[model samples]
Target chain A: MADSTKKKITVLMVGNPNVGKSALFNRMTGANAMVSNYPGTTVDFTSGTLIEGRQEYEIIDVPGTYSLEPRDAAEEVAVRMIRDHPDAVVMIVFDATKIDRGLYIALEVMEQGMLCIVAVNMMDTAHDKKISVDTADLQKVLGVPVVATTATSGEGIRELAEQIRKAQVADLDKIIKRLNGEIPDKKSVGGCGGCGGC
Target chain B: MQKKLLELEFGERGVVREIRTSVHDLNCMGIRVDRELKMVTKQPIKGPVVVLLGEMQIAIGLDLAAQIIVDVIGKDA
Candidate 1:
């Protein structure tokens, strides 16, 4: 009962250890990924199918890593997953309270020139801890569709899935320029607005 | 004083001083030199030891913990 005619878009979930990547993956794909509080819970990758906007996606939950440089077996697996699926759309997950640490690996993945989207997961915990991350600002900085999500309560899951099609390969130079305030705000300019024309 | 991370009792706080092995592995987990770490919990029978790194809690196995040396920084009351 599979649709052989339709091509599946591959999406790799990458992030630092224990940023709720597995939790977000479970919410998106309805697949039971081993979820736990501690880091290193997911030392391997799990695959699941997701259908959104009449398109099928094969989502792979990759092992968490702090950077692209392989430091351990789990990190090696994450590095290999990116190498194996060079064309896959990378879904980078970040703990809302620790976005800085997650950004390191996100930059590494973006440097590889893959289409990417960002999920600032654990919003509930961040809210409890009095931490707030501006997803819109992050989107502008990375030039990717960034969505704030709380995987535990199923908040913002639908919007994240819908934004997958809007994923884009970010330009490092552009991101640097935007961060330095060298580039004018795209929305104010009234061009494409970097919305992926959707 | 300097002691292996595994020797830090529960609720003990310390700053990482040296890592004898798997430097990259420990560093990736936020166990780099000069970073403050607090012992959160320890599993019995040599299981993973949980430590607080900044606002994050990381569970490191004993083998890796034994390789990390930390300078004692008092304990939480």
Candidate 2:
């Protein structure tokens, strides 16, 4: 249970189906979200509490969807969760092996102008497939905190939790500029990268 | 050799030809036309069928599978 005196931040975990969103949610919140390898395993949203570094988060495990366009009842629920929690920080989860597919929806969520962070889950499977995602590059391009994690093994989860405070509303134009090498990398001339952890 | 995805036997391979219904839903699930896929398993009693799309395995309901038309490529021995 979270202490009522502390301000609780709402974090919504969103991702593609079977991208380990539930596993990552269970890891962060210690909630028993049924984990499975198949898609549509979680059709409804589940909420739990997570206390990290004296800050409490009301984390909601949103049903996974490929896009905001609701084609099914489950997808409708996922879209509604984002609309209902307007001020919540969206934690977009992705399978490290299939970043492109997840990025499509991530961009859709970011386009709504919400504070967002990214967790690249399934690092172990990505490594096994010889696929490597540069989190630093992703962070620079999206202008959000991107953390690579293997939720099943509890790797990099702490950093993800700590970096939630650094979530940013991504600028679509700037993202394009950065991707095209039009803007200089911020890390080259920066103080703590404005991670709010200095 | 076009057939409904639901008709594909276990360990059969095919490329998606068309999705009759819920095109957006099936696309989101990575079942787009022209994407090669393999039938991994089909549960008895008209339960969900699992298919391998690239390195990912997706379990789709029988109704959904029945709507997906696939061009049979080969069968795994």
Candidate 3:
């Protein structure tokens, strides 16, 4: 079990584009400051901290990417960091309507031997689609905690944080098949929607 | 009262996290998006109000956007 207090753990916020990585960062870090950065402004990553219920943790919002391999300079940093191994990984935050595609990244992270907490984001849209995911089943298969959320409305941010605190490096081998023949290679995909579609 | 995607971020709104644009939309706007990002607008704004990829700004108006949402994101919605 990873101790939440002793080590300087960094929780990396990752997922496909537009699933609300930035929104989740704002919710977790309260980055209500720093708005516009000129017209052509682009930022690779941002760091924020969470001080909640007397517990503290560092959060880094990596640029969103589809895979974990370097296809471009910006995504290379994000993908490389995961391979380099930060502290913890949160995989979820993609098009809710595209669940199959979203799981692709989760499988990639699992391959890296990191204990993960799958965030099944965009429940509002899922509800609209009449899709009810068996979160327990997802947890059972993914071998980690799974929390559904509409990050913008902040439906499951707390659960996500709590789950992050509880994450353990589970057996990464169990998820090798679900990668859709792809790994956490962010370099293998398209450009970022950060300009801001994901 | 607005004509550009940059206009949406104005006033007291959430922090502008990202902006997504499409070359397809720009060709329609007849506006050259020299940089990697840009926005698109149409008259009467008869569509959904959306921020694509959060960048390639297209003010399709609410009615059109609602219809498009039902068509595009409805399957997932």
**Chain A (alone) TM-scores for all candidate structures:** 0.94, 0.93, 0.75
| Residue A40 Cα positional deviation in candidate 3, in Å, after optimal superposition | 12
lDDT of 3 by residue, A1-198 (tens): 334766656777777656667777788788852333222111377888886555677777777665676456666767876766555655455546556556767666766777566677778877887777766555555556777777779898887876676565546564454334433333313532111112
lDDT of each residue in B16-76, candidate 2, tens digit only: 9998997766776667899999999999898899999987788999998989999999998
Candidate 2 structure quality by residue, lDDT tens digits, A164-198: 87889988998899789998765545524432233
lDDT of each: 0.89, 0.89, 0.55
lDDT of 1 by residue, B19-41 (tens): 89977666655677898989999
Fnat per candidate:
0.23, 0.23, 0.00
Q: Which residue pairs does candidate 1 place in steric collision?
A: none
lDDT, candidate 3, residue A138? 56
How would you encode candidate 1's per-residue C-alpha lDDT over A65-123 as one tens digit per residue? Answer: 99889879999999999999998999999999887678878888999999999999999
What's the best-to-worst order under DockQ?
Answer: 2, 1, 3
Higher-scoring candidate on TM-score, 2 or 3: 2
TM-scores across all candidates?
0.75, 0.75, 0.57
